[model samples]
Target: AQTVTQSQPEMSVQEAETVTLSCTYDTSESDYYLFWYKQPPSRQMILVIRQEAYKQQNATENRFSVNFQKAAKSFSLKISDSQLGDAAMYFCAYKTILAGGGADGLTFGKGTHLIIQP
Candidate 1:
């Protein structure tokens, strides 16, 4: 089975500094999607951003973005102008892109602990 890997267990950024979280995955399937989800102290898995396997352009959402290297199977998240609210546990997730994909369970990494410097 394909699996997501988060090499960095923890990361800290200044209130206005930018931080990048590392994420890597191994999958044989060609059609799939990669996602970055944030789990705050409340434990809600908020979808921060995502990328499609076929898209050449990286996915971005407001201050969040992804550096997706399809050939290397790497999908890292970059947060710009970090803030206290950005402190949380971030997870790397993967899922197939087709019918019944939802039926198959989603794969997630252990998650990276993000800290914000006041």
Candidate 2:
């Protein structure tokens, strides 16, 4: 089993600025994937970014990027140029890669409420 932890329960950032959300995980499996998901008021879980444990390079998507430290088991999300649309509940999640290219159910953190101040 895997577990993810978000130290911050909530974070605030000014519009057009940058904010980094911290996350850490514990797992005994060697093959797995880390992810950052954003859930808006609509209750839709949006994929923000993902990092494979086998990959050394951090994952990035537009203004969203991750600082992945495999050894330290840290995967944090950096939201650059934060916008009102970015305001949501950000969750850190992970799932172990199973044989036959299958994956287990995602394990998510408590989540951090991101507030984009205008």
Candidate 3:
């Protein structure tokens, strides 16, 4: 079973600063996937970024980057030049199996509430 963990329950960043959210996972499989998702007050889960376990290089987006440590099973998300729009619930998610093949949806962490200061 693969499980994702987000250590910080809450975090805050200034309007134009940067913030990194910590995440770790436990997986026995060498080839799997990790993802970062953002859920706003609207409760919509949006994909922030994704990383394939086999890839040694990290994954990054416009304002997001990941520190993927395959050996340590850690994946952290860094939000740079943060904006008020980035203030939301950030979740670390892992894609794994279940009893059947329907578990491809996602297994998410408790989530970190990101607050942005004006």
Candidate 4:
């Protein structure tokens, strides 16, 4: 079974400061995909960033980026400049790389709670 792991249950960061959320996963397949999703108070899980297993370069979007270590199965998210709006529950997810694999949806980790400090 493929499992995603988020070591940090809670983390706080001051405004404008950077913070990194740790994540890891266990997967036997080589071509799987990894993702970091942010769930705000609205409870909508929004995709922050994603890294394909085959991509050597890390994935990034605006202030959000990921450190993807394929061999170690580590995929951590980095927030360049923290904001109050960034406070939310972050979930690490993974899915098979096949065409219909997404039909079953992604397997998500327990999630990490992010708190923005003034």
Candidate 5:
């Protein structure tokens, strides 16, 4: 089984600034995918970025990036130039990579509420 932990229950950042959300995980699987998801007021889970465990490079998408420390089992999301639209609940999740190009169910963290101050 895999588990994810978000140490920060909430974080605040001024608009146009940057904020990083911390996440750590415990897993026995050797191969998997780490992900960051954002759920806004509309209650839709949006994929921010993803990092493959086998890849050494961190994943980045536009203003969203991740600091992935494989050995440390830490995956943190860094949001640059934060906007009001960024305000939402951020969740750290992971899924084990299975054989035959299959993957297991996703396990998510408790989530960190991100607040963007105008």
Candidate 6:
């Protein structure tokens, strides 16, 4: 079975600071996809970043970035100059090579609740 692991359950950073959340997964397939999703208190699932297993370079989206170590099966998210708006529950999700062929859904980790300090 493919499983995503979020080592940190909770994290906090002051306004304007930076923080990184760790994630790792176990998969037998060589080709797959990984994602970091943000769910605010409103419970809306938002895509923060995504990385394809075949890509060697990391993925970045404005203030967000990822450190993807394919061999180590690690994918961590880095939030630079974190703002109050960054406060939310971050979830790491993975899609198997065989899943999501149009009718399947995504598999997600428990989640990392981020608290922004003033």
Model 3 Cα displacement at 91 (Å)?
A: 0.8
lDDT of 6 by residue, 8-87 (tens): 99999999999999999998889988999999997789999999999999999999999999999999999999999999
lDDT of 4 by residue, 78-112 (tens): 99889999999999999887774346479999999
RMSD (CA, Å), each prediction: 1.3, 1.2, 2.2, 1.4, 1.3, 1.7
Q: Encode model 3's per-residue lDDT on 1-118: one tens digit a residue.
A: 6688889999988998999999998978777789999999987889999999888999999989999999988899999999999989999999864455674767789999999998
The lDDT values for all models are 0.92, 0.94, 0.89, 0.92, 0.94, 0.92
Count of steric clashes across candidates, in order: 0, 0, 0, 0, 0, 0
Cα displacement (angstroms), candidate 6, residue 41, comes to 0.5
Model 5: lowest-lDDT 10 consecutive positions: 97-106
How would you encode candidate 2's per-residue C-alpha lDDT over 17-99 as one tens digit per residue? 99999999999988899999999987889899999999988899999999999889999999999999999999999988888
lDDT for residue 66 in candidate 4, whole number 0-100: 91
When summed lDDT is taken over every stretch of 10 residues in candidate 4, the lowest stretch is 96-105
lDDT per residue (tens digit) for residues 22-114 in model 5: 999998877889999999987889988999999998888999999999889999999999999999999999999888866578899999999
Q: Quantify how close model 3 is to the true structure by its C-alpha RMSD in Å.
A: 2.2
lDDT for 75 in candidate 4 is: 94
Off by over 4 Å in 5: 101-103
Stretches > 4 Å off in candidate 1: 100-102
Quickly count the clashes in candidate 6: 0
The superposed Cα distance between candidate 2 and the true structure at residue 23, in angstroms, equals 0.5
What is candidate 6's TM-score against the reference? 0.94
